[model samples]
Target chain A: MLKAPALEARARAISKELRCLVCQNESIDESNADLAHDLRVLLRQRLMAGDTDQQAIDFIVKRYGDFVLLKPPVEPATYFLWFGPPAVLIVGAVGALLFVRRRNRVRAEPAPLSAQERQRIDVLLREPN
Target chain B: MRRILFIVPIVLFLAVVTYFFVAMRGGYNPSVVPSAMVGKPVPAFDLPGPPSPPNYAGPPVKLGFTNRDMLGRVVVVNFFASWCVPCRVEHPVLMGLGPSANVPVVGIAYKDKGQDAIGFLNEYGNPYVAIALDESGRTGIDFGVYGVPETYVVDKQGIIRLRHVGPLTAESVAREILPVVRALQVQP
Candidate 1:
């Protein structure tokens, strides 16, 4: 069995990563809402009472939903929440790269100035000077 | 043009990150009253009072009253539980408000056993006129109660004028609840 202080520290660390179900977005550690505070106290008490780390998390998850986890489980139903952003980033990067390459390839190279056009340009430059 | 186009994805990414950060900070404030429920009459309720226990030494009161009994009188219906810590914190505030606020206050013992509710009232000093047991939370559901320590102020006309969603503080009572009661008193 871990010392009480060690157990408390571990509990705090775990709770900081868990969202308060009642508050939705707040980690259990940071929320001052009554439910959040109650959950934190409960977590600490359970830890002191000899619940293992997994047991503690499982206890909360059972009562609340998977929503209580800050990092949601990478299950089939939650795959989008976990992987959607990175997938968007990768797709955006690839799309942008492809667009730039296509634009470069399709850019109209300035029509090479013919000899007559060059001479006319030279005359215009001289006249301007 | 390419450089500007490149910045779009980055900007979008930044916006998504900012949203997540704001959400993590719990930017959604819970105290704001929902506009939909505001100015609307409170849902009707006729809750059964908790079962009277043997040797219950608290206030002598009956069970089952109508909304009319609550209206035209400044009344507070507080939802509380013995396990809730905030209920303990707000008990004295409710007690103080009972006599001074010119209103009758009632208690809704939510999701707790009768014995526990009686014991809680005994320990806390029954500040309520009557205690209703919401053992199954059906009454609380009718009132749309999300949690314990919620106080509702019903107008003389039986409309729920205001809901204080959390623990009652002295400042909130003075600033919010008192003015509403004062207005209700002068209604013709």
Candidate 2:
């Protein structure tokens, strides 16, 4: 049997990772919102009542839906929300690299400074000295 | 040319960092109150008043007509539950506001039992003038209360001036709540 304090601590740790369904961004541990508080209290109660960690989470998930999870399951429907950020980052990096390479190629063929421009620069440098 | 290349990457990195910072700071926006509710009229709600003395625990006396009568006053409705640790942290701040501030402070006991609510008030020192029992959470639903310790400041005209979706600290009370109350008091 889990000791009371240990159980409470475990519940709190799990709650910190779980989002409060009512307050989308806030964890059940950090949010003082009613639902979060209730969820926390319920979690503690469940822990004390001998519910396993998975059981406690499953109970909440059953009631509140998957939206309460911060790192939601990567299922067919949520494939986009879960993978979207990293995918975007990869795409952006590749695009940036391609753009830089193209720019480098264009710049590599740079025409030598024109004779007229070089002559003007030489005159300006002499006059300044 | 070298300097431009260096500066471009640095600027891009800074921009990405700043975006994450802002997004993290704002956290999540719950669907309870849309951005439109800001500076809009507060929802009209008339709940039971605080319990009376002898049995009177703290702020909320009893459920009565007078409790509902205070509707037109500039009111601050706070939702709290005994189990919420952050609510305990914010208790003193609410207690201090009762006598000092011009607004009427009311408490809504969200989904808590009467005995527990009374015990919580006795232990923490109630700052609310009246505490309504939202046992069924019906009142909470009406107020768009997504969480406990949320304070809504309503004007005399019953327009909600501000809805703070977290615990009220001294700094927040001064910065957010006070100014709105002062403005509403002066308005009509």
Candidate 3:
């Protein structure tokens, strides 16, 4: 832990962004894994050495790749990961709209029950015993 | 149009099923994260041998190696620990690598006590041409090692070509390690 509270807080913030490679699910800040501890220590050291937050993050990212970041950066390979859900939602919404519109159009007033159909209905009613 | 629309859900369901079927058949293990260091030059660090030399049983040997030592030679760098169970299983395979493969195999004892590493090496027959003690595991972090018993094949230019996670099996030795080392050796 750093002696300076501000620095320590900064360190903690940075650690939260890094995924503990061993634990996979937990951020380095929350992990008890040895690797996570080391990374936490490394992050503090980098901060103390006057590295900007980006530089410190970049240091780990360079070693471990973008997977180390809790939030993956936007890139060509990750376009699907970032946009696929919204794209699916938009497509689904459009499909539902088209479906509902088609249903509404089919149900609309039934062409006022055309005159010929009405007359047939009347004839059938008059023939009933 | 409605007929086609009715089939859409089935088509989507089948697509999802096919995706899973292919992934399952491919033997995908989610835990195996690919190394980010491949194709990059080895991380810079100077690591030393075990603190006390008396534990070693073998003939006197070069204790440590730096990134510079890796240049101009194809070498296999292995990260192992005395406490790591799989490393013991992988030990004999490492022992054979030095002689049968004819390439220098370097060892970095990760986060292990100097004495324990020396003891492990003495008991198992030392396979490393050069051994480095990574007591703090700073070097291991630089190499992006998440676990023990990870192996890397470095090319003559000191760039990391391959990283084998987990204990190396004989099949992996025959397939991944030997082939990469051989290919790197012939390159000028």
Candidate 4:
């Protein structure tokens, strides 16, 4: 067993990032399933072998797909998952803002007087009625 | 324009809800993860142990499969165990593979005790050319087998073409597995 505190802490951090495939909703660190245990052991072995954190993660990701990672890497396949909600929110907010601003601008602006209307106003002013 | 904007959020919400409702109709098994090994060559390692006699019986050809065993033919590799209920459910469908379907099904009994495997096969007929015992689950990890009752369809060139998770039902067999096998066998 790897008893080094630093290694143990790093292993824990890595395990938490991995999803236990048998228990879909839980992380490998928290799962008691055999597959999860196997994964946890593999992660620890990699860490103790002086592999960097990303290297350790890459091993797991290669074995399993991005689905095994709780937070999958942002790629063409998953672009929508990562940026989609924020993109929609920003687009909707900007659209609504533009709409509201245009409406308000229309309400605030005074109507331009036509030539005939100006002439009628002048006549009314002259007659003082 | 402003009225349209006012309805946008509701419209989006309805679309999202409709997607989920339609998706749920296919049924759900959250534990399944798409196998990464699909499209890749068969994992290199000799499957340990030999197929059990009488119950876990099939063609008398081989005891266990190696990387070389998969060449020159389309085959199905089934990961199963006695403990898994779903494996039992799918066993009958698998039994038809060898004699009826003319497709060799390689079995790997994952993390199962040997005698229990024999007992399981004795109770439920086995449809495997050979049943290899993956005692340590290293082979399972190599094959990306996270759950039991997962099946892989390999092409003649030893490339994995399709992965089916969970039990093989008659519906899934006809709809998913059979069509893929038929297509792969033709031409290339």
- On DockQ, the candidate that comes out on top is 3
Cα lDDT tens digits for candidate 4, B1-188: 76996798799899999988887876855556778888988888786664445444335635566867888888888888889999988888887765655678888888887677767878887687667788778888888888888899989998889999889988888888888887877836
List residue ranges in candidate 1 displaced over 4 A.
Answer: A1-117, A120-129, B1-36, B51-64
Error of 3 at A26 (Å): 0.5
lDDT of 4 by residue, A1-129 (tens): 479998999999989999998878899999999899998898988998899999999887876888989998889999999999999899989978988999999999978999999999999989954
Worst 10 residues of 2 chain B by lDDT: B59-68
| DockQ of candidate 2 relative to the true structure | 0.08
Give one digit per residue, the lDDT tens place, for model 1 in B33-105.
Answer: 3322335566666777767632455556655465556765767888999988999999898988878876788
Give the DockQ (2 decimals) of all models.
0.04, 0.08, 0.74, 0.61
Judge candidate 4 at residue A52 and give its lDDT. 98
- For model 1, what is the error of residue A52's alpha carbon versus the real structure, in angstroms, after optimal superposition? 45
Best candidate (score: TM-score): 3
Model 2 residue runs over 4 Å out of place are A1-129, B1-6, B18-36, B49-70
Ranking by DockQ: 3, 4, 2, 1
List runs of model 3 lying over 4 Å from the truth.
A118-129, B52-60
| CA error at residue B63 for candidate 3, angstroms | 0.6
Error of 4 at B142 (Å): 1.6
lDDT of 2 by residue, A1-129 (tens): 235678878997889878875657889888877667767777787888889998988766654456667777889999988788999899889979988999999989987889999999899989954
CAPRI class assigned to model 1: incorrect
Per residue, candidate 3 scores C-alpha lDDT tens digits across B42-124 of: 99999888865434456666687788988899999999999999999999888888788899898999999878988888788
Instruction: Please give the TM-score for the first chain of candidate 1.
Output: 0.73
Model 3: per-residue Cα lDDT over A24-85, one tens digit each: 99999999999999999999999999999999999999899898999999999999999999
State which candidate, 1 or 3, has the greater DockQ.
3
